[model samples]
Target: MDVLIVDDEPLARERLTRMVDQLDGYRVVGQAGDTASALGAISAQDPDVVLLDVRMPGEDGLSAAHQIGELDDPPAVIFCTAFDQYALDAFGTDAVGYLLKPVRAEQLLEVLEKARRPNKLQRQAKQTEASQSSHNGRSHISARTPRGVELIPLEEVRYFIADQKYVTVHHLKGEHLLDETLKELEEEFGNRFLRTHRSALVSVQHIQAMERNGDGHYQVRLADTEQRPPVSRRHAGALKDLLQKL
Candidate 1:
């Protein structure tokens, strides 16, 4: 199998490359540090299997797999990560395999032996799901920053407001600009977030009250924060009805 090794760390990539090199049945075709480069490698090398890291600087592995799922001919994926907590989410992407960090050569070799590409029909079905945004929603939001990747639990996020191309993730710790759009966020976090405006998705847990400002516009107040994102007339009625049910 032609294998593509993707990880943010140079050492991790080199180590996996070396392991795959020693294996008789597989060949390392390319290496990548993040999702963008990985996609490019996938296009250029057309590897049969990808060893993807779960967490990275900007786009995490799961999201990358979700994107990869859209391809007409997608490769089998084997996720690599330090945290075992993401195992379930990793599998949800229909990955053929999953490996923990400090991967054992024997384990990797076994996974390779088992990796099978989905048939054309199966690939089409997965692509359809991705187009419809029906894949399993992520449990935690992957936030990218200058320091490193920060995994924010869904519970900590108060709201997500669209700002031009990016969505602002307002959490208990503060706010971070997420690359995801408001629509995608709403689709992934349905039931957990209530749409107050076209640009805002407020967490149900954080919404404390519905208020009317002096200007007569309605607003949704979030817990532990003074900033209230305006409620649009289109969704105001639905928001009010849902809030009253609680």
Candidate 2:
């Protein structure tokens, strides 16, 4: 398998390269420091798997992945980030895997295998399907501020937190208090978002880890951010099952 290591740090790239070297069936075709070099290599070498860094000097991995998707045969993307939030959006692009920093060799090889034999067409089809589902009735979601029925891009939303009668939409930019309740939003967007707590709906991508507290209560840790949302006891089991899959 042809692999491209895209990261800002030379040591990180070298570490991954060493792991790939030890593996029998894989070869490191190229190494890039930043987004420009990464994209150029993709255009030139057309690697089979791009081990992309979540944070970079110029263009971030997520932005580069969007551009790469425009290619006729884009390589499989496996994100390598020190942070966590990018995983959610990363998977939205048919990403086969997401690895945290100082990646385990076993995990890398496992993801590489999955990337090697995946139904790319089916994954793309699912994205198209999800997008189509988002479009049909999203416009009807009333906004609180005169932001007035803002067309919330389905993928951009980090999560929705219910507060009494209103649910606030949390995203990278900031927060918006939408008029709809958690129940209403969940019914409309349940397929894409997962219910993490009685009062919170987490973007599955933002979830990096779910830990059990001293009292056996569970809490969710968000990627790239420090805030941890406590999981309702009722939803703890379900959230644990979901975390296992991620």
- The digit string of per-residue lDDT tens for model 1 on 182-234 reads 76776567657776765678988778888899989888999988889877544
- As a whole number from 0 to 100, the lDDT of residue 68 in candidate 1 is 83
Candidate 1 stretches greater than 4 Å from native: 116-246
Worst 10 residues of 2 by lDDT: 119-128
lDDT of 2 by residue, 1-246 (tens): 678999999999999999999998889989999888987887556577899998998788888888877654467888999888877888887577899887998998888888877433344335436755774546333455665556566566777887545678876656788767676676566656666665678777778888877878677877655556667543465567667887
CA lDDT of each candidate? 0.81, 0.74
What TM-score, computed on C-alpha atoms, does each candidate reach?
A: 0.48, 0.48
TM-score of 2: 0.48
> How far is 118's C-alpha from truth in model 1 (Å)?
7.5
In terms of lDDT, model 2 sits at: 0.74
Instruction: Using lDDT, give the best candidate's number.
Output: 1
Model 1 has an lDDT value of 0.81
